[model samples]
Target: MILYPAIDLKDGKAVRLLRGDMDKATVFNDDPAAQALEFVAAGCEWLHLVDLNGAFAGEPVNAAAVEAILSQSKTPAQLGGGIRDMATIERWLDKGLARVILGTVAVENPALVREAAAAFPGKIAVGIDARDGRVATKGWAEVTDVDAVELAKSYEDAGVAAIIYTDINRDGAMQGPNIEATAALARAVTIPVIASGGVSSLKDLKDLRDCGAALNGAISGRALYDGALDLKEALKALAG
Candidate 1:
């Protein structure tokens, strides 16, 4: 399992939101590029970035911050938020994003996902953020009745690279990830599912590693920033 350190960009600063609430964010670093480099420095294999402003805007608003991270780090990165159309996908890929995650659009227009997957091959991933098993869209601002497992199943044959599954209620709360729910979703589909939301300690990471489902990896934010989870130690545990 690969360990992905998260850098959530809000207004050009790296911050972690409490349960997807923009108003409840805690800024971790003013220079996101330096923060990304720190992760790379810590031996992290991959970086997970989300454009918070972009997610709500329906377009990329943290372009400069993202560009800064890309310019500094050679480590492969996956980004989600505000990537809505073919043009945006093309642009991000051109900007050197290793993988572009299609979240909101995956729910609004699945055909675009198929088309983009066909075009990008392994460079495209689907982000399914759910609350109580229902998918949320528009930056987790709206909850839909669509079952998360069903949505993931629909993309199984679309040639998408992977699925990033975040349990909304657990995100940023540091309550630990919903392993049962996330693993159930993983078993329901063949796509590689990366667990997100609350990844708090070495135990949490190890639990996910031993969870039996074939998950891609896990994304940790607050725990890492709050010093609750040591990056180097967590990486070592996941690698084990």
Candidate 2:
């Protein structure tokens, strides 16, 4: 398991939300690029970034902050939120993002997912944020009737790199990840699934590592920021 460290940007600052609520966000860093470097310094293999503002605005809002991170860190990073079109996808990739995660478009415009996947191959990933197993879009502000597994399965042949499955309720709650749900999603689809939200401890990382679904990784934000989970320790545990 890769143990991706998350950097959620809101108004150009690093923050973690309570159940995806924009107003409930708690800022952790004044400089997102500095936070990205901290994760890199601790030897994280990959970074998971979400533009909270962009997700809500449906366009890149934290572009400067994200670019600042890319400029400072050499570690490969994957980003999601507010990226709804081909032009935006191409722009981020060209700006040195290792992967562009398509979430809302994966539900609203699956054809775009296919087109982007075909165009970028391993550079594209689908983010499935679920609330009670139904997909939530537009920064988790809108919930849809679409089943997460079915959506992921639809892209089985799309050649997208991975599926980032996040349990919205568990996100930033520090209540631990929904291992069974994430594992089930991984088993239900051919795409690699990365678990996100509420990953709070070293044991949580181990649980995901041994979850038996061949997860690509698990994302942790609040835990690391609050010192509940040490990045180097979690990375070592996952590596072991």
Candidate 3:
């Protein structure tokens, strides 16, 4: 299991939103590139980035910040939010993104997900963010009736790299991840499932690891930023 330190970009600054609410953002750092490097120095193998502005606009809005991070960090990073079309996907990949995560497209336009996944195997992933176990789209602003597991299963044959399961209610709240729900969804799908949301402690990571069936990795943000979890220790534990 890889511990991805999240550098969520909001207005070109690293900020974390409470419950996925854009208006409720807390700025953690102004220099995202430096932040990315810090995470890499801390021994994190991969970085997770989200474009908050892009997710709402349905287009790339924080390219400069993302580029800065890419240019400075040696570790691979995966990005999501506002990456809806092939051109955007191509552009990001051309700019050196290791993997592009499709959330809205996976729900609104699945064919595009298939096309991108087919075009770039192991370079595209689906971000299934759920509120109340039902998937949400457009950055969690809109909730759909689709079950999170069903949505993940729909993309199994699409050849996506991984299914990023985020429990929106747990996100940025330091409440701990939805391990039971995430484990259940992972078991229900063939694709690798990465857990997100509310990962506040090392104990939480151990719990996810102990799930033992389909758990792949977990994403953490606020806990890391606030010093509640140590990146180096977590990485060592995961690697061991």
Ten residues in a row with the worst lDDT in model 3?
209-218
Alpha carbon RMSD to native, model 1 = 0.6
lDDT of 3 by residue, 1-240 (tens): 888899999999999999999989999999999899999999898999999999999998999999999988878999998999999999999999999999998989999999999999999999999999999999899999999989998887999999999999999999999989999999999899899999999999999999866577999999999999999989999999
Q: By how many angstroms RMSD does model 3 differ from the true structure?
A: 0.7
Name model 3 segments beyond 4 Å from true: none
Residue-by-residue lDDT tens digits, candidate 1, 1-240: 877899999999999999999999999999999999989999999899999999999999999999999999999999999999999999999999999999999999999999999999999999999999999999999999999999999998999999999999999999999999999999999999999999998889888888999888999988989999999888876776
Q: All candidates' lDDT scores?
A: 0.94, 0.95, 0.93
| Per-prediction TM-score to the true structure, in the order listed | 0.99, 0.99, 0.99
Alpha carbon lDDT at 42, candidate 2: 98
lDDT, candidate 2, equals 0.95
lDDT accuracy of residue 16 in candidate 3: 93
TM-score of 1: 0.99
